[model samples]
Structure formats: structure tokens, C-alpha cells
Target chain A: MKTIKQISVFSENRPGKLEKVTKVLADNGINIRAITIASSEKFGVIKFLVDRTQAALDLLKQQGFTVAQNEIMAIEISDEPGGLHRLADLLARKKVNIENASGFVIEASKKAVILVEAADIEQAKSELQNEGLRFLSEEEIIQ
Target chain B: MFWDKKIETISRSGLERLQLKRLKSTLAGINKNVPFYKDKLKKLKIKPDKIRNLEEIRNLPFTTREDLRANYPYGLLAVSLDHVVRLHTSSGTTGKPKAILFSRKDIEQAADLIARCLVMTGMKKNEVFQNMMSYGMFTGGLVMHYGAEKVGLLVIPAGPGNTDRQISLMQDFKSNAIHITPSFALYLADVLEKKGVDPRKDLFLKRAYMGAEPYTEATRNKIEAIYGIDVYNSYGLSEMNGPGVAFECPEKNGMHIWEDNFLVELVDPKTNGPVPEGKEGELVLTTLCREAMPIIRYRTGDLTSIIPGKCRCGRTHRRVSRMTGRTDDMFIVRGVNIFPQQIERVLMAIQGVGRNYQITLDSLDDMTVKVEIRKELFDGKVDHLVNLQNTITEKLRDEIMVRPRVELLEPGALPPSEGKAKRVLDNRTL
Candidate 1:
């Protein structure tokens, strides 16, 4: 079972915060493989899949930023139409709630990877793999 | 280890005898020297000779903050203006600022009294003392400053609000003791950890004198554990010569009021009469030895009780428990009286609640308490977070007897303050 480390940063919903956060990771030579922002009216949480997970976590924490890291599942799927719908249908049948998710195309018009955060990561990973979906390793996601 | 053993260790009978003598002299001094007290005494048909015993103090009228405010600059002075040595004014965050006068003798005595308190708390003359309370008219700063100096400690008058400099000064001077407000102590603890200065390994702070605002005992324990220091609860107000009126001895049971310089009394705030011993009441005080402006029966709004037991330190001065709350600090929600300290006590006892919080009373029907959940406890699950919020609400309801809507805010969402942290906001129309 392979797992990818995802970093979540708690940030206030102020202008230019996202810029500052990306600047911290960029300056520290960490590449953001996938990213998403979950925001409310007053604040937001920025989720990132970075190449150097621990380094990015430490740098953000050293800058007085609240950061947390968790092991999440990253699956590579077909980039064709209904790619996400098929996976969603499979997880829905199994009642796997996707607490948070983000995806980006790795190979244009052919392949893509979806990062998922579920309440039970192991359960979701095993159920998705049993349905013949391919999972990406940490190194493969970084590459 | 005692600073003034003869005065501090006097027996109960001996203390009463001295109080009576000083009370007579003070009554005489005010009746003859100040026309305000003279007129009040004459109106009450009371004579200086009438106060022959300590029990007769009940006959005297209470001198309230309003009276102090009405007198303003010099109306309450018991001595001539030429003899007034120094002056310190209340912060006056609410109404007209009060001016407190101190003669040269008053200054020396206040320093001596505070020195005695420091010594009682296990502070020594050889240790380095850093004064972090604000200076300039805020009595907490200069009063403790003079007292630490008198105790023969190396004084670092590092005023509040510069956290890095405060830490560096402690490192530079190797300061072993500090005088600061309790809220600022919590803020400093946060800053110290952010700077990676583990107090146990990097600093030499062993003693802390915290007062000027009400704090829960849980707060005291948190500060002590964070820095590995003995944080003593200090009690005082500018009217009673600030920061030296009462302090905790080494036993940490309760703060011993130095009854030699000031006469302490506990009274029912509503009836303005004495309460039974060991009961919560308003703290009333009379300046016994003050020559410049000896206030009589000054009603301190702080609410506390006299602890029932004697201190193990052998000091004969009676001890007062930690101030629970101020009479003015209580707010009504659905006809239930709630104190901010009550909420604080409940929050501090919980595992995940952080130091900073805000209580906003929206109306009699709606009250909300905003707290910061510690970052470590934020598991990023909405249901888990809701459970934590419900737990806090239930705990607070159980403690304060009022159910308040609890909102869990992110870390650092609340405002940062170095002085008294404003914790309550009453947004009710009524």
C-alpha cells in the first residue's frame, strides 16, 4: 500500500495570503504537485501535495503558520470523460465519503491523478484498489 | 527570610492594638488636616475620639471610588500640597481618572511593604528582578520597581510589550524573577516558545509576581508549568499603595495581606457591612500608616474571602484567597449572573482550549463564547470539531449555570494584547 503525504495550512481569509504561502514553499525549493483551497467567509484551509512534504511543513511552521500533514491516497485514472464519475460511483456504492479531494492532469488527454482525503484512508484505499484502480506511489507523485 | 519580622509576625491581639492606635491617629490627622473628612465626620456627628475600638469602624461611612473621583486632584489629601512627594493615577479606563498621592514617607513605606511581599514569596536580595508591568502612572510598574530595588535585587525595569527584548534581557542579565500582569505572562510564554527559548534550559527565571488583573488558578499552574517557575498570585489596587497590599507566601495557599501598613476588612458588597469570616465579600481597606492621603474604609471592588487557616510560613498577617471576580465584572444573561473568570476556569480545565478567548453576550437570550482550539487538536474533521465544541459548551454550562453557544475559532484568531486582555463583549441592547 502506497500513500502520499498531503500538507494542510490554516490561513486567514485575507488578500495576498495564498501568495505568501506559495512564496514560502517556492523559496524553500518545494514543488506543489497538487493544491486546493477550502474557504469560508473569514478563513480558509490550503491543502497541498508537495514534493518535500516535511521540509514544507517545517518551513511553514517556522513562519508561524499552522500546518498539518496526513497520509492520503493518490490514484491515477483515465483522463477521458466520466473518469471522475466512474470513480465517484464506485466510492459512492461503498459509502466512502470523500472528505477532501483535488486532481490535476499528469498526461494531457490521456492520464490524470486524483488526491483524496477520507475519514478512513485505509478502507478507502483498499476498496478503490479492489475495483482495479491504479494507485500512485509517493515518488511517482513527486516525479 | 522575613523582611520586617517584628511587624509581619505580630500576634492577632498585638495587630489589633496597633490598628486601633493607628486608626485613632489617622482619624485625628484627617479631622484636623483635611476639611473634606472633617466636614463628613462632623455631619455624621462622629468625633475622632469616638473610634476607640476596631469594631467601631462599622460606624464610619464607606469611601467609594465615586468619592475619590468627586474629590479629583487634591480634595482627598490629608496633608498640605507642599508635603506631597509623588502621585500615581488610576488607568481610568472607564470614568474620571483618580489621582493617588504619596508622601516621601508613603513612597518609602510602599517600597518596604512590597519588599516584604517579595521576600515572603522566596525572592532573595541576590536575584535579578525584571519589572515587566507598564510604568508611568500605572502603579503596578513603579511600585514593584521601587520594591524590588529596596529588596536589594538587581532591577531591570523592562517595561511591557517588547517580547524579544524581554527574553534577551533575561538572557543577558540572567534575571531570576519577574513582575508582570497575568495576561502578559501568558503572551510572553507564547513568544518564548516561538523564539525557541525553553525557559527550563535557556533562562534562569525562578519566580514570577502576577497581578493587576483577575486570573484563574489554572492560569497560574499553566504559567508555572510552561516556564518551570513559581508564579505567585499578587493582589493590590492603586488605592492601597499598589502591588504590595497582599501576596502569596511560599505555601501558595493564599495571599497574606500586610496588615501592619493597611487595615483589611471584608464586607458584604450589597449591605456595606461585615460578612462572616471565610465568606466571599468585597475587600474594604483603611490606610493605617499613610500620612499624605490616608483613605478610610476604601471599598475595593475586588471579590474574595479570608482563608480560614493560618499560613505555615509563620507570618501573622491574615491571608485572602485569590480574587474570584470583580463585582463590576459580572454580566447577566437570561437573569443568570456570569463572570468571565468562571468561563476562563472552565476553559482552562479543558484539554484543548487555548489561552485566548472572547465572551460576547449578544442579548439576554443569546450568548456566545469564542475559543481557540489548540492546533494539535484540530483533526480537520467537522464532526469531531463539533463534538469538541459541544463538550466545551456542556462543561461551561455545568460550571457557570448558563448554556452559551460555543464557537471554536482557529488558533490566533483572537486579538493579541499585552495588558489586560479584553475577554468580554456585551452587545446586548439592554
Candidate 2:
């Protein structure tokens, strides 16, 4: 079963400040898989899914970066429109609630991987697979 | 020649040495023209050139924000208003808005300084830069916009708001950089996500230069990770030239001040004496480049320090640490100096009180403090609002010497902040 590791990297909203956070992950050879920023002009909350989830979390936390570990869903869907909607609808049908969803495409003409914080990960994955939705591997996201 | 001098090379040292000269000239000018300074300086028996170095400079009476208010519109300007090319005024906590003046040179210098800061953070020439800082009246937008333009970068004058247009420009023109407050940047990111567009992959943003309010390290990482770019810290005051006094270099550790253009002083906020290097003190600035209104030992009220060193980025000019806090931020809650941040720290510690909070002084009454906490109260299941409030009030009373009337507001009801969230409202009529 593939899983998504939501790695939180603490940073200030000033320039070159982000370099410190990304540098830690890059320095430790942890590859960033998917990233999306929830930020205001003054501050931001950066969420990342990396290759070595536990290592990245430990390193960032030890470095005094307030990193939190949360489980996110690694959902695979067809590369066409409404693919996301169908997968979400399937999860809803199974009563699997998505708290937040974000992801990136592997490449052109392939499935798009999404990282979702759902109420129930096992139920979500089971429902999606039952609905014929393809789940992506953690290796593919890091690649 | 100015560019060769590390102090003059977009860094802050050149500005500081230059401030000495400006401080002298401005003091002399003020003594000759401005009635208040003329009286004060003469009474203190301080002559123009004699007021040299830090010790002598301290003897000179400091300029305060209250002084600016007392002076009102024109009294603060050292040069005539005709020489003043523009004006930016924000309503202070006082009845009348505090006003600041800038000459053509002053504006150009500020813009040029900002331009250097832009390039320092990897802003390429002709890159389509979108300035989301508020335009007009607010100095943030125009100063940076001109600065980017001065550096020959393509500018998108997408002021503030108008989310659709900003998105369309990002999609169409492919903007490379943006200058906005951190909150607005997050908001734009949200809009981009809502539009089903990934900002990192689609947009060409290489930088998000943000400042105006203090933000946590968490915010910085979030902005950079989402946008996939560098975020630079820029610090300045409307009293001084806005947005270009000091800026963070590519090294990302601390901010370098353009010391040649502005004499930067770090004084014990209370004593008005120089604080030790690297020590936090009220940042008082002397503008060496302003033709319209050159301020001398003008207390910025904003707290920071003179880093005093050569930066790894090879800039010899001195740098200042990120603005830690402000001096006048102190609130006399029941006759004790209480910084809202102290209260905020306590409030954030409690799960019941959400982020947004307001502390107001009841004027018509006995000048009692009423704290309105707007939070995600329902999220906490401990029936803890009253207990949490009581705990906070007790902590505040112990720390700040005052009891607060804690009124809890529903989540998202307090005024949503686009810039620095105003945390306090002094309802007391002075």
C-alpha cells in the first residue's frame, strides 16, 4: 500500500529564507516529491512530501524547524478531465472525507498523483481500488 | 565610484557613513528652518559639525512619532514641499494620519535600493515582475515597482487585489517574480490552486520578497515550497524611505542595510544611547539622501540591531538582524508595559483561542482593557473557552499587570488581514 508523508518545513516569509528549509532536505539527499504552499503575504505554511519521509521529518525537527508528520493519500487518476472528480466522488460514496488535496503529475500523458489528507486512509484506498482507480507508488512521486 | 564602495553597493554601510553627513546637514537645516528643532538644538548648545559620532549624536534630542504628529504636514519636511515629489501618509493610532514626504531623489534612491534588493534575490533583467503591494498612498507598491523598472525588469502593475487579472497575467505573460506581503502571497497561491493551476510548475516566479510584518519561520518555508522560489526579507519604515533601507542577501542569514544613504542607529529605546553591537534596540534612522525631508536621529520605533560584520555574500556593508519587535509596541495595560506579542504567545499556546484577537481599551469607562479573542473555539472539545480565557487572563495579569475581559468571537469573524493584522484597538480617547 502506497502512502503520502506530509512533511512540514518551518520557514519565514522572507526571501532566501526558504533556501534554508529546502537546503536541509536537499542536503540530506531527501527528494521533494510534491509541494504546495498555504501562505499569506507575511507568513506561510509549507507542506512537502519527500522520498525519506521519516528522515526528513526528524532532520527538519532537529534543526529547530517545526515539522509535523501527517498522513496524506497518494491517489492515482487518469490524465483526463473529471478524473479527480470521479475519484473524489468514489471516496465520498465510501464516506471517506478529504481534508485537503494537492499533488503533481508524473509526466505528460500519464496518471496524476494527488496527496490527500483523508478521514480514513485504508478505507479511502480500498474504495478507490474497488472503483477501479489506480494508486501510484511512492517511488514514482519521488522520481 | 559609489558602486565600488561596498557600503554604497546596495548594502547599508555606505548609507550609514553617509548618514553622518546627512545627520549634520539635516540638523543644521532643521536648526535654521524648522522652529521646533531650531529651539531644541540651540538650547542643547549642539552645533552642526560638533555633533559627530555616536556620543555627540546622542546628545541631540531624538525625533519621535509624536513629534511628527505634532508637526503635522509640513513641519517635518526639511526642504520645501515643492521639492517634495510625493507624499505617503497612513492613519496612525492618532486622529490625523501621520504623513511622510519624499523628493524625486529620495524616491529614486529608495526605488534604486529596492531594485538592488530585487536583483540580489535573483531577479533577472526584463523578467515580468508583478508587484502586488498596495499602490498609491501606500509606499510599498510604487517603491518596489520603480525599483524593478530601474533595474530594467518588465513590470506588471497589478496593484493589490484583482485576483482574476493577476492570475490571467501569470497564465498569459508568465510573470517571473512578485513583490507582496506574505499573507497576500498565500492568498494568491490559494487563488492559483483554486483555479486548478499549480503555481510552481506553471508560473515563472523565482522570488517572493516580503516584509511589513513579522512572520514565523514556518510561513517562509510554506511560501517557498508552494511557489518553488526564493523569499527575501526587506525591512524599512514609512518614516524612513519605505522598503529599501535594508534587505536580505542571497546568504539568507541576515539583512544588509544601505548604510551610505541612511545613517542607521540602534539605541536603547528608553535611554536613546547606542546599544551594543548585535543587541536589540530601537532603530533610529537619519536620512542622508532625502531632499524633501531629511530626518535626524528620527526614532523608527521599530526594533532591530546593527549586525556589524562582513557578510559571506561578499558585501562589506553592515547588516541588521530581522526586525525582532518594536519599542513603542508596549501597551500600558493597568500601568504595565505589555507587548501584544507576549499576549499572542499566550493565546497561541491555548488551543481554544484561535489566531485572530483584538485588545481594546474602553475609553468612556475606566479605561479598562477588553480582549476580544476570535478563534476556532469549536475545534477544542474541552469546554475550555472559559477556562482557557481565565488561564490567559491570569497569565496576562501576572505578566502584564492587568485583568482582561475576554470576549470570544466565532472563527473568521474578526477583520481578515491582508497585511499586518492590527491586533489592538485603543478605544481610549486621548
Candidate 3:
């Protein structure tokens, strides 16, 4: 398993705010490998796994967006009916709390990568490793 | 202890009699000396002789800021330029500034009135007074300076800004009294706390005169708690010879208007007529004793109300409540008249809201407001933030009669203003 820097940006929950943030990252040639939005009534936190994490964070911060970085483990699991459940069950057994998480299939019908944000990411990783799980590296995700 | 006991404590009938005498003379003087007033009166078919009593003031037309700007430099001066000893001007945001002239006698009277307010606030000759307002054409600085000198106080003419020097002066010289605006006073309170100087012990600040802007009672309480001093509200304008027009006495209930100098009226701004007694409306004032530039029936554009009773301080002059906001500052959003003070009241009542906020009106297809929330409220809980926004939105709709978009910003994200806090930003061209 590999821990990647997941950048979370706080923005106004209004039209064009998301577009504005994405446009700034896109203009700077930052590729979004995986993205998920957790929104409330007034604001939204957009979590991103990008090809250039530091560049994306710096650019968004320069544009006056509140940005933060968190370490999360990205795992590649079998693209089966119980893929997410299996990962959740392992984390729960070890008393690891999942703060947030998102996943997508890179190779359809075979394998999928789920980005898991846990309270103690290292503990989550060690436990997952003890259970014989495989993680997608930064090189693999960018490619 | 009364500066002008005979005048200040006169009976209401006696005061009105004196006011009528001064009003008649002022009316005749302006009609004979100033062409603008002469023309305005002639067009309205009004004559100085027609004013039988003080109540006849209603027959005269109101003088607005537009009228003053149209005249520009010396259009409203009743006396010649050589006799005009000093001049002050309004900051004309939309057009030309209105120039106010003061004769030597007018300056002395103004100083005397300011000294009367000072004495009412317990300013003594033994105490050192520090003036912390801008000393240029703005009337707040020099007006208080002249009054402090008149009252025989050792006045330190410390102009505004430079908080370090101000704190040092207060510490070194044991300055017991100060004159400052409410906003600057709040900022200075923070600086003083950070410098580790306890205002109650390390410093000798006893009384403060706050004016030049409208502030809430909560803000006054905050400043008082920070400085451990008595804060008095001083109200005036350049057109009315500055900071002596009215003042709060020991009671601190309402500011007493100097009826001998200013004839005050509360009128419905839209209809230009009187409102019910003690009802809030636009303040309309007429200078009774001014010689150089006697503005008759001048509309101040400030919203306040006459207290309708005598102050407990034994001053016979009628008092007016603290000003809430300006008529010109009111903006119409979604066909609803909204005052910034209404929104401020709502925001201040809510917990976790910061002292600073900005209301921006944007016009894309329809007019919408964007309210910036403080950063401290963002505790990283997305659900809590959403609930807070929705609560504010619902409360704003209930309070201001309009729903606005809320955006939570980092602390100190909004731009800081130099002088007054720019509260509203209307980007709508229409």
C-alpha cells in the first residue's frame, strides 16, 4: 500500500466555484487522478488525488482557496461485488475509523483502486498489509 | 458647573422664545445675504416676515446635500470671505464637496459648546487630554482640540494612527481623557492588550469621547470592558461646526442637542414632514447662531430620534438617541429597503460570528447578496458548517426580508479599509 497526498479544498457551495478551482488546476496542467466532493449547505470540501499534488495545492492556495493536505492509503482491490465491503470490514476489525473515502475502477471488471482516508493512516496501512492487500503506487495512478 | 447656566437650564417656553428670536434673525440674515436662500425662498413664495413662531419652520423648504453641492465653494456663505475665519468640507463621494465656513465668533461659540460637552463628561483642567482624530479639514480633531484648550486642559494634539505612540503618550503623560472614533478605539483596545499595558492600572485613561461614526451599544460595552473607562458619545457634523452640537452627559441615556445653537427636527425623510414624537426619522437641523454660513432647514441625512424628555443631568435641552445609520447608506435589494444595521444586529447576536463582515450585491441575472462568514466558525465539520449557513440564511431572510448567499472565508480574508469600514459593496449597475 502507498500513502498519497490527498489535497482537500474548501470552497463556496455555489455555481462556478468548483469550475473556478478546477480551471485553475487544469490551466496549470495538474491532472486529477481521482476526485470526490463532500458538501454541506454553504460550503463543500473537494478532495483530490492529482498527478502534481504540490503544484495543485500551491495554485489553489494562490487563488485564495482554503487548501489542506492529508495522507491517505490507495489500495487496488478485485473489481467484485464485495470489494469495498472487504476493505471496510478489515478496517473496522482493527478499530480504524474512516474519515472519508472514494474509489474508482482503472481496469474495468478486473481491478479497482479505493482511496481510503482513515484516522490513523499508517495503522490502516499496516493492518491492510497484514491482511495481504495490494496498493496502487503514485507511478501507476499517474500513468 | 454649567457653562451657560442661564441658557442651558432655561424653561422650555423660554428656550423656544430665544430660539424663535434667533431663528427669525438667521432667516432674515440668510435671505438678505445669500443669493441661494433668497432665490429658494422667493421661488417658494416664502418670506422671512411670514415666520410668526418657531412652528412656522415647517413652512420653509428642506435643504439637502445636493443643494449644498450645487453651490460648491462659497454659494451658501452669509458673511464675506474675509470674515470667515475657518472652513471645513464634507467628503463628497458622489459629487463636489460641500464647503462649510465659520466666522471667528462662530469658532468661539463652537469651542464654548464643545467645552460645555467636555465639562459635562467630567473633563477637568488637571487632566491631560489626547486628541486622536485626523487634524486636517475633518472637524473631529481641531474641534475637540479647541474645546480642550478652552477648558484649560493640557492638550496633546496627537493626530490619528500610530497606536504605539498613542499608548506611550498615555502611559508617560498620564493622559486621563481622549477623543477618538469608535472603530479606531476598538482597534487600539486590541493593540493595548497585546502590549501588556493594563488600561485600569498601567494607564490613566478615565474618559473617552467617541464619535465620527455610528456604533452599537454592544461595541460600546466591548470598548468599555477592554479599557475600563467611561465612553461618551459625541455627535456633530462639519456643517454644524463639528463636535459640540450634542453630547452624552453622566446619564449616558441620550445625547443632548444644544438647542441654543441648533434647532433640531425629526422628519420623515420621504415626505419631508414631522414624525410622531420620539419616533425615529431623519434628523433635520437649522443653525440658529451661525454667522458665516447659516444653513437653514438643512437635512443631515442621519437617522435618529428625539428623546422627547429632559435629561436627568439637569440640562433643559432635548436629547436625541444615538444615530443608527444614514439614509443614503440604505440599499434596496429585491425591492426591499434594507439597512446595514439590521443585518449587523442579526449577525452580532449569533455566536461564533467575527466582528468583521462584508455584504456584496452581485447582479448576474437577478440581484443577490454574498455575505462573508468568519473563519473561526469553520471547525472542519462539513455538516455543522452547512447547518450554520442555513441558519444564517433563514435568519437573514427573516431579519432583512431577503435571503442571501453565505460564504465562509478565512480569518482576515476580507480587505481591510483605511478609515471607515466599507460594509456594503453593490456591484449592480442598475
Measured against the native two-chain assembly using Cα atoms, what DockQ does each of the candidate structures obtain, in the order listed?
Answer: 0.26, 0.02, 0.21
Index of the highest-TM-score prediction: 1
Residue-by-residue lDDT tens digits, candidate 3, B149-189: 99999999998888889999998999998898876786676
Candidate 2 Cα deviation (angstroms), residue B120: 1.9
lDDT (Cα, tens digit) per residue for candidate 2, span B150-257: 888889888877777888887798888777776667657756765778988888778878887665455666788888998988887788778878888888888877
| iRMSD (1 decimal) for each model | 2.9, 10.7, 3.2
The TM-score of chain B in candidate 3 is 0.92
Better of 2 and 3 by lDDT: 3
Candidate 2 lDDT score at position A33: 68
- Considering DockQ, which of the candidate structures 2 and 3 is the better prediction for this target? 3
TM-score of 1: 0.90
For model 2, the stretches where C-alpha displacement exceeds 4 angstroms are A1-143, B1-19, B52-54, B328-415, B425-430
Can you write out model 3's per-residue Cα lDDT over A41-131, one digit (the tens) per residue? Answer: 5567788889998889889767766677878788888899998888888778888877778888888989998888886777777777767
- In terms of lDDT, the best-performing candidate is 1
lDDT of 3 at B73: 89
Off by over 4 Å in 1: A12-33, A37-44, A76-98, A102-114, A122-133, A139-143, B360-368, B402-410, B425-430
**Error at A66, model 2, angstroms:** 25
- How high is the lDDT of residue B220 in model 1? 95
Model 2 / residue B418 / CA error / Å:
3.1
lDDT of 1: 0.87
